[model samples]
Target: MTISERPVQSRQDYDGRSPFPGAHEHPAASRTQVGLTGAIVVLPFIALVIAILLAWGRGIAIADLLLAAALYVVTGFGVTVGFHRLLTHGSFTTRPWLRVVLGVAGSMTFQGNVIDWVATHRRHHAFTDRPGDPHSPYRYGTSLRGQLRGLAHAHLGWMFADEPTSTPRYAPDLLADPAMVRLARAFPALCAASLALPFLTGWAISGTLYGGLTGLLWAGLVRVALLQHVTWSVNSLCHVIGSRPYRTRRHDRSTNLWPLALLSFGESWHNGHHSDPTCARHGMGRGQIDPSAGLIRLFERLCWATDVRWPDPERLERRRVDVARKARAPAGD
Candidate 1:
């Protein structure tokens, strides 16, 4: 069925509110809470600075660079493929063990617990650039000054906001699962392990305290900070810049920024995703490199993932704004 022809559900359904539930209120963050949130965002940059200083004296080793790249890929995919496509959107189905592994790896990124991450993301989709969206560059007015403020807000300032998205209101499915609940509770431990493991690996490989520190700097802090900015760019620049080739729901102005495609693992195909959120493949067009989609395809081939929601060309054609405009135009014109 066409999008317009599909049965419309209530706002509650679209928001993923639980039918069976108590109040899922997210209270305003206190002064102390906001301070802590700011610290979390800032500490990584501090680490990056320290890493650079250390590199200035010792020089960056191949092992350090390799470790950082490897960990970045793992934790990055943990967010893109794991927290996003698999948990938030259900673009594909995987084995139970694989789900746990993905969830743990994602938690290691320190983005948030799985449940909270999914809840915030689902809420973002439900509201998009509209009033209830947790993060949107259009939240403020559209004036030049307002746009600049909103860009910063959407990019990283939103995380320091007093209020947060309620899990019960937006991720009841994840809350209902015992395994997910367990994983969410383990977020703290996973974060500690994420940093510690790299340190230990460096120490073991080089048998020196400096090696361990370098590993912690590169794989732990620098990697996390890099991923964090790349992800935030999607929220800010993806809406403000790039090409919008597909027709999305009203008020949704997601765009595809090719420069971020590789770093974000295809998530920069924001227009394609907002147009068809559940499609496993975001880079539908040619020459669009989507490593995440390629990884999903590999899993499918290996029988590790099933019922993958690969993009449909017919649906894409139907959603193309140019095509829709042509179809609606007078034949003589």
Candidate 2:
């Protein structure tokens, strides 16, 4: 008989698979260095200061006001309904054409592409207020100095740092779509058009070069700056200060600060969202008045969205009871 049999292999010879992707998965940050993050941050305050000075000196005009209002609503909703509640959290669904339109309009705001945005956001949710969280205000622990550092990190320092999430791992669904790829590639052009559109409209409406210039400054630059801060504030202020009326898990420090409710487009209802991440509505309580929710309802009515995950009273009741029990638990004395 054959004496040429090979030795049996050890069990340890086969390497176990890791849940994360390998080298081919993630592409590096696309040369869009966040060096401009600091510049963008500082420049906005300067723009605001300049705006105040101009307004005080009677340099403001009716067209400037109109353009500012228009851009604020457009880009603001684009981030809220498009980038945030829709794309990042999958709070709702939309039709094919609407999806492309939202992606394009959202790119005009010059936030990162949908894939990166969703990736970072998923990481944020995966480790909220924990060490690995992309932007956690609780990273430094609960001391005064630590909270200060954590707050700064949560606000804008995360962008200033180089801790980007891998899109292939966190946002494979988004990255696989060709429509999103086209929008991401065309992002710069869309942003340029966004800036120029207001100016063109102002020029056409007012029939003056000065109107176009002011529109670019006010509606274009200033608008971007303002929206950026509002979006970042959700990562910063919302974490630090808010009312946790709903029953999110104990470690999750999400709250609903009423003052920022409107500006954040129902996103300030943090506790509700943390409790049910996939539900289409964050502002689940009565009288919350979520404009984004209203828009989602419109999409559903128009057949642009199906399978909408609206809130359920029974689930909400069970959650509240669970929270109440935990709150009343006796200390281990």
Candidate 3:
């Protein structure tokens, strides 16, 4: 079983108290940390504004859009396939070099380093919608007012809470891997390269500094912002909205938000994923488009990935929630 598939302790519903010892939010982030997070969160919107202004002044370059699309696919997949499935969930195995490649690519997206990202996500599964979940939208309470506040918390506010997930406790395996350790330590450099690559590419291609600036705006800042929110939406919106065709653990309100499938590279099949955390494919149902899963399949075909834990039909059938029974189920907290 994957690390995430390990048995998790059950907990009572959240009742405005700590779920575990020392579970309370830490002190507010340091000024430097807050400023850094602000840059990560707010700079993209600033880039968007500049992009709009530039669009009005001179139509957005087709080259800029294309470069943005390319980087989005690369970095986005680096998270979904690399950091998430391969590293966090152990959904498949790849050769050593590809593993480091994926790790570096994901680090560029301005998410935390690979180790911290995996640790936080593993902790999320261990606690789910309960009080211990790092980013659960149900954090505040079930009331409308609480849900609103919790949504904000889950979407981005939690980053400022400074609640650290201990890497040694949650990601010991990564720490033991020299390649991952080095890659995790190089996170800042990778992020800089992530931005610089687009600018340099645009400059090289167009032979103009203006081209490079626009590339940075759209491909660098805007791409990071868009992917960040789409991933965050899986944390905040997926739990509150969307249909739940599969039964997850009690209080685990993960849901399948289709609108996010393409943008999130199929990671938004949240309910399906929560049902079988170790499965490689999140979009288990027919007609559910899952680009990440498709990419994994491609890697497997190319002999780059193996031991892929594709969904088992019989197992899925066993986990499927009967529609009639689900209708009688009480509303989620």
Candidate 4:
């Protein structure tokens, strides 16, 4: 049965409203929250160290490699295609069962509740790399030290802050959905599933408890750690290292880092995405290999997704021209 059907009881927990005049937050950061973020941030680094040690000593089995790859693909797409595209952007649609499954899988990514995910992501797009951008890789200005600090900030440090983005403005649609709301509330369980399922699969396949432990360590914890970095790289590395193929209103430097394309699904095509936010496919160009788009197309063939906003040649050409004009125009025209 679909899980998003539970009715919302009250608006007390809702934080979707734009605060009124004179209700400004005295800007602050919570040290406790920062410490928690530090823990989360450091935990992954330690996991990386452990993984490297394991690999160096050859503790990881072939089965663990296969299991890790399999889990990464699932959770990666859960965030890329399912969480970012389907739920956050509404670029296309999905069947009820698949939708619920995707939502649950994405929750296990340990990002946040689905509504919060969608809301924060939408706000990021709304003000990418700009002042209101919650996690811009260039927040601290254009000095080398600043860029380093900003990249660190953008990658995951911003999560240390306590000021939550009011979800009502960014994700009213998701908030209104009965099933999505319920699925969002199931985030804690989904996170546990993310970790436990890998161990269960490993034990069942290898018929050993040691296999299960490695699976949980590699596929469950370590995999989440790696994918989390890759996902955040769209915000940090993509901004700092890649090429900007398209234009955007936001002053943010979003690049299409080719190295990350396969790993991040089509999301490495960040410039195109920022330019055409509602388009179903981020890698709209011919050479771009977007597995997420392919999956969506598969769904379309099966009569699941509809109203896909595929790129149009005319519109793309115009967008390019507009970008050139903005770049080359006289300073005071």
Highest TM-score, which number? 3
Off by over 4 Å in 1: 1-28, 323-333
Please list all clashing residue pairs in model 2, or write none if there are none: none
* Cα lDDT tens digits for candidate 1, 1-333: 001111112243222222111112223566886786787688888988898898897788788889989999999999999999999999999999989888988898878899988988998898776657777776665668667877888898777765466777678888888999999989889989999988998998889999999999888888888898898998899988998889887667799999999999999999999999999988878999899999999999999999999988898999887956747955212
Candidate 4 segments whose C-alpha is farther than 4 A from its true place = 1-36, 51-59, 321-333
The models' CA-based lDDT, in order, is: 0.82, 0.71, 0.87, 0.75
Q: Listing every candidate in turn, what is its Cα RMSD in Å to the true structure after a full C-alpha superposition?
A: 7.5, 9.4, 3.9, 6.9
Q: How many residue pairs clash in each candidate?
A: 0, 0, 0, 4
Please report how far candidate 3 places residue 13 from its true position, in Å: 5.5
lDDT of 4 by residue, 197-309 (tens): 98998898889996787788788888888888888999898877977667666355677788888988888988778778888888867798787888888888988878777
* All candidates: TM-score: 0.88, 0.85, 0.93, 0.85
Ranking by lDDT: 3, 1, 4, 2
Say which candidate scores most in lDDT.
Answer: 3
Clashing pairs in 3: none
Candidate 2 C-alpha lDDT tens digits along 102-152:
777778776766667777888778756544566777665556876787778
Q: What's the CA error at residue 296 for candidate 4, in Å? A: 0.8
